[model samples]
Target: MQTYPIPMVPGPVVVPEAIRQVYLEPYGSGDLEVEFVELVTRTQRRLKAIFGTRDDIVIQSGEGMLVLWSALKSCLVPGDRVLAVATGVFGYGIGEMAQSIGAEVKTLGFSYDETINDMARIEAAIAEFKPRMITAVHCETPSGTLNPLEELGRLKHAYRVPLFYVDTVAGAGGVPVLADDWHIDLCLGGSQKCLSAPPDISFLSVSPKAWEIIDAVGYVGYDALKPFQHAVENRYFPYTPSWQGVAALYAAAGLLLDEGLENSFNRHDAVARFCRRRLVEMGIDLFPAPGAVPSPTVTAARIPQGFTWEAWDRRLRAEGLVVAGSYGPLAGKVFRLGHMGSQADKELVTQALEVIAATLK
Candidate 1:
């Protein structure tokens, strides 16, 4: 496989040597190894701190979508009402996933270039729909926008919503995801994005309310969260666990904690701001709507007028610079530059931007 010299894609970021080194050595079986369970617990502790939650953290062996499906299936039964608040691709797609599982979903959608800020409209939806769950995406990577969850959380609490699910996959480590304060029941996360690890592990913070729903629903499948709920205590897992993936996750989470999450947030914020400023200086138009808040993890900019997305992407690739293209409606019109995890370095971003500048010339 040809690895791009510059990795500015949205996920599966270039893993640092510190995180990758653990995979080089051999480890014991995840099912029998007491240390593996300890590793899982320890990683969960670190993730809880990062997520700003006291809720139980469930780690599984798969990519980010694994836990996303797990959370929805575990907590909801067929015909359950789900109010999916959509601002972009992932936000809207998650709703479709719910529908696939037989959920009677009402998608409260917004423009692709915007974030979820219309709380009054959302509250009215919640009031009328009386959904069992309210789902949202904290950072919509495709559009490079961040939705403020504090107000939404307050609404969730005030309305007595049974569950509030959020996918903070792209923003968990580099951004603030206060699960407890936000009254989020299932705060979904991934290893690849801001966690600075390979894309093999998935995790989520499960609140007491979410656990209750999981128990009640009794969902059984490969993606079910129930098995994980007691796996540690029982010294077992649903399937053979990958010690390498868990170990990598442990190291990655530790790195974030050591740096202090606030510092990570500041670094990502500074880098993203700089990235946007430079893009604007180069006469590039950003994709986020005027009122939408841009994410600290990724920047989505309009493809320069003359070049088709295919040609622009090919040019960037020829220069050994690889960023991501937008999905859904924004496809072929917007490109995303990820600056999260190990790729969040300012120097790295500068180099990538230089390549972009040269390509656009």
Candidate 2:
């Protein structure tokens, strides 16, 4: 039997065989304009449902980091204050990006092992910093931790913060996102993650308040939201978009909607539980503490005492399973098991775990 490498990484997950057909379709036909418009429109509607936002949803032609940067760049000018809440590597990276944009960035950082659920500290930072924008990552994939975005969103509203941003790249389909109800002014996601698509497109949902700020600032070039807004209003793209990626995402969104968002999230939860249980049975300790909220998209576990991450990772790859290694403070000490998108299934997860069990024994 012919075998392929199984990707258990967080993003750019395994694409469903059905969606792969989208790539084989021809591009640049006479119907390209009409077909692309319909694809974009349908994808935007499905994205709104997934993010739970009634606001503007823009699909950008780049990785998730591009949308993250665009969201921050559009809203913030030099000297604007931003309060970034960091629980893991990706959460901290948001703050770094803000700083690069010349925003006055202050991070309220928690330990890697802890979820960002400390409301008291967050409140103190909000009161002291009086930031124009607040940023957080809903699912910190590297540490397998989930932040309390609902509580953070409530705090943002209570304080009347002008802009509130959430990076849900790893959380979008696998977890619940109440963007409108929770007062998330800007929410970002990537197709490569829980959407189960290739890694070429990122998306953002923009609220009216955030749009007003963006319009006033008037950013330019590829990083600007104005061009995307123009494209949306006129039903044309700002620049040449990756039609292949667009088609693939359209098909992927169909798969997600057909399965229903709630059902998809429930499947992720069940798969995560199964993965965690199997890891425990294999005598591996999970990274996040018992009380902390762990991410349903991925599971972070401590590497076995006798083996290094490099050694174990090599072994897993040799067995045709490609898991992820940790970053930041946990580099080489922790390994991650991704159960997102199409990979969040009992059969696939069981196969990967069986490999781990055999290799470790």
Candidate 3:
């Protein structure tokens, strides 16, 4: 394997040295408790700010997918129906999770490269199925497409039957996520994306409406905490939490807040635009559609014909750049460059594009 001078691929983007300094502090002391609790609480608040919601946040001990499954199993019952506005892999997965939890899943699946066109179909399905929840991925990373979340939220509200559950795993920090204004019920995000932290930490914000629904049902065995009463034990995971991931997540949230939410979104938006502009200047075609509909957190491009995907991957890797290949059906046909985390800067993105141009020769 040849090695280039630059390290490519998004995340595990170079962790900042200052954030790493948190682990240097002593642990398991009374002081540690104060620091840890404050850190977690503050991070939750910062997440609320980014989500633009009064919804309560839960810092779960696993990947965003785990938290996502938790929401499905907790809110839905055996006979309840769920409507999923699916455009890509993650959106499909949300529908599957609802199905696994015994809910009847009804998906309005769109082509991989396109956004969900049939909001009317979604509304019609809700009316036909009378579903209790609507699951959606705010940005479908697999296709690099952004769904119309505000409109979807509005539709769910109008239907008055199903609540909206948003998976903002890729879109939270980089895109505008107005959970309150949009009337989103449950929203989830991960630390590894725009927060520029490690992958283990993920968060979920539950609105008052969600609580009412869940309270009417029962408890979610995984990470259920009692909000109103002191007698109920807040059941966290059966094991100790990831201290390092938590500390890094808190520090990353602090960094994100310091940067400010709007600034963070604009930073990612600008980088994504730069990438698209450079691609167009190079005479390379993007996946399709307007840049606005594409995910601001990632860019997916068609691999040039006649060149094998593996050859291009090897060429880029030899130059120390590591972009992602498309999944499943998209494999070999499309390549993805993540703009989240530390790669959310123009310098890094330009360096990546430079590597690609050179590799093409």
TM-score per prediction, in order, is: 0.98, 0.96, 0.90
Per-residue alpha-carbon lDDT of candidate 3 for residues 304-346, written as tens digits (9 for 90 to 100): 7656789888888877888878776778888888888677879
Off by over 4 Å in 1: none
Among all candidates shown, the one with the greatest TM-score = 1
Ranking by TM-score: 1, 2, 3
Separately for all candidates shown, the number of backbone clashes (residues 3 or more apart, or on different chains) is 0, 0, 0
- The whole-model lDDT of each prediction reads 0.92, 0.89, 0.76
How well does model 2 score by local distance difference test?
Answer: 0.89
Candidate 1: RMSD to truth? 0.9
**Candidate 1, residues 1-361: lDDT per residue as tens digits?**
8888888998989888999899998785556989889989999899999999999999989999998899999988889999999999998999999999999999999998888877899989988998999999999999999988898888889989999999999989999889999999999999999988999999999999888899999988888888888999999899998899999999999999999999999999999999999999999999998989999999999999999999999999999899999888899999999999888899999999999888878
CA deviation > 4 Å runs, candidate 2: 1-5, 29-32
Q: For candidate 2, write residues 1-361 as lDDT tens digits.
A: 5344666888778888888888888887522477787778888998999999899898888999998999988889999999999988988899999999899999999888888776998998998899999999999989998887888888899999999999999999889998998899999999988989988989999999998999999988787887777685576666788888878888888898899988998999999999999999999999998789988999999999899999998888889988999998999999998899988988999989999999998
- Full candidate order by lDDT, most accurate first: 1, 2, 3
